[model samples]
Target: MKIAVFFVGEVRDAGFNASALAGADVATAEGLAEISIISGVRYDQDAIRARLAEVVPEVDGLVFIGGQGNITTPEIAAQYPGKKFAIVQGQKTGPNLASYDVLQEDSAFLAGALAARLTQSGTVGHLSGHRVPPGLKGRAAFVAGARQANPDIQVLTGFCGTQDDRTVTKAWAAAEISAGADIIFTMLNDARSGAIEACREGRARQIGNAMDWVEVDPEVFIASAIARIDLGVKGAIKDMVAGIIPDTPVHLGLAQGDFASLSMGGDVLDVHKEYIAKIAQDIRNGTCTVPNTYDGPEFQP
Candidate 1:
């Protein structure tokens, strides 16, 4: 079956779009489904909607990656009865729309613990594109995880003002590094490449989100928190193909290989795997509850 995904940025995207594309490609290769991706640069909601409107007829289903507010709203989906809809990072308003969600707090907790255990500088930082839900929740979980490992470790935060601006993002990372944050978890979408560059220049290790960036730069990007949008997309497509798509939102977590997880690369600190695994287990079992937001200081560049 053929599927279409409406992404809010260019094809060379870094965070969510890239991961979803990667997942879609893999799904096609594995014979699960075929996917066509369409992008409209951020904020051109009208143009994006027009593109999707044009592309929808050619595919069996349409997946909107972060387009709930732009491409199609609950009202819009309600108007398209026969069109199968799956949304990555969207709200569930009614039947025929499947919303894919990532349980980021679990993986962010893992990342925080990893950062605190490895940082030579006693301070860890989070770089983001906005002070929004998943990013904020991830950063907050990171802080909780870090403190759970080392109670006194300081956490730094910064925002790049936009998801696609690398210059601003890179500068933010540099400033965070100058403040002695040796490990940074970047959730800045396409701007993450900038943070990775900054980490390399500062000789600090980095953690990425939404993809298996364990080897993005073996030296600087030593860890990644996976938000597996690809898996979510693939699963949603499979359900659509099978005519069993769920109308309510689908939440993927540690138990679901598709949702989120923190992976340690070979280049990172040689912390015992069991230590990290235990934290993950606690999160999965509800033994460790990760707070969903951090009311910490956030700098905008």
Candidate 2:
């Protein structure tokens, strides 16, 4: 069997994309599947449609990794109605399309809780890549979690509008810190490093995304909400290969090991470990509900 994975941005050095690629590699190893990966610089509907038309015929299945906005766009879906497609972040329901959405809000909530517990100034900030649903959901969940931990906590917010714009993001992080935000949470693809730099320069703390950034900024990076998209993609491929594709979306969360908070590499502070453990248990026990970009409440700003 052959699978084609279309990503929104280049996966050359991105931690999140690398994780998804690792998942794809695992699927190939187990199922003897041939995989082809493609990435575009922007979420151009016409471009994605043209590319899909050119490549879909040769592949057995399609996997859209990350970039919730671009993958869920109506234009792309309309062009490939009958093609078997699976998306990682957002929900796009169709006859041949399935979504393996990550329970990001839950993970973000945990990160926020940890940030609140670790912050010394009682002020946390969220640096978003865009004002889009996924980014906003992460910020909102973080705020929700932080509030739960400390109602008096002040959560500042900012956005870079795109994931690749590191300069603007660094400026935003610096501005947030200048405004008295000591603990920062960045939910960007490659912009996480820029936020880390701003934090390091400003002498603040940060909660990294996708993977921990302890090696780069150990003193500042308190934790990371790591996502493993490979498991979901591999499972989708298996179902498609077996002709067992489900009519409903495949939602992966802590239960499926698709998302979690990592304390490895000294990314998580010792003080926040207990809080992270408790939140992880809450997610597993269904007591703590995390938000979904598609199903959760819409966020403004």
Candidate 3:
């Protein structure tokens, strides 16, 4: 299969692409496919549709990573047929498109739960990047999970409204830490480095999003909320190989071994190993539900 990856802006900095790209690489390793990248996707729907129109005909499979996010309406896919589209972290649905919706709240909740347990000050902080529905869902779930662990646990939440301004994000983290938030979930996208730095300097712990961060800073990072975008990519590719391009969006979450999980590397994790396992099972079995998004203010300790 000759597949082209649709990158929203620069291919180098797209956080959602890492796992999908890894999936494509895995298919390439199996000698089943070749990968090509397409970039410069504008946020506008018309522009994105046009861009896809220009690129779709050339590739056997079209994978749009973070292209206009979700398609609760399916007009775009109908306009482009024959070519299969694998959308990672998107909510678009259509016969020609296989969209992957990674329910990050599951892992986010786990992160919140863990954070609740870790804090001696009864306070934890959450820092967010750009506002997207899924991102909002993850943030809300973090608070919910923390509260689940400790009803009295204080959650200090804030949004930078931008993903790359490290200085600004660092300030946000600093403020939260100063307020006695010992652990903060830095969902500040690319600006997370600054928040992590702040957490380290303040002697406050930090949580990772998507990929593991322990190797990056073991002393500061207690754990990472593992969002399995990789599974979405790999699964979509296998579907492509099977000769069927799903029109509906595929939901990936804890139930399918794609649970946004916390890494088992930390000593604290070992302590909560049983709890984590039980919770994972509950989430997988549909006994426990994590809200993807919630509406609220910046909660304080």
Q: Give the alpha carbon lDDT tens digit for every residue of 136-234 in model 1.
A: 677788888899999999889766667888888889999999988999988867777778789889998898887778866668876888787777778
The candidate that achieves the highest TM-score relative to the unseen native structure: 1
Residues 40-134, model 3: lDDT tens digits: 56546777767777877787877666535464214555766766766777777667766777777888888898899888899999988657666
- TM-score, cand. 2 vs. native: 0.87
Report the C-alpha lDDT of model 2 over 1-301, residue by residue, as the tens digit: 6778777666754656766777778887786467888776365656666677777777767777775534443345556665567776656656677667666666788878887877788888887765655566777788888878888887886666767777877888888888888988888777666777888899998777766565555787766766656666677677767656566667777876646554433645565687677878888888877654323332123
Instruction: Report lDDT (CA) for all predictions.
Output: 0.76, 0.70, 0.75
TM agreement with the true structure for every prediction? 0.88, 0.87, 0.87
Clash pairs, candidate 1, are none
After superposition, candidate 1 runs with Cα above 4 Å error: 30-34, 57-60, 67-71, 267-272
The candidate that wins on lDDT is 1
Q: Clashes in candidate 2: how many?
A: 0
Candidates 1 and 2 compared by TM-score, better number? 1
In angstroms, the error of model 2 at 258 is 6.0
Show the lowest summed lDDT stretch of 10 residues, model 3.
67-76
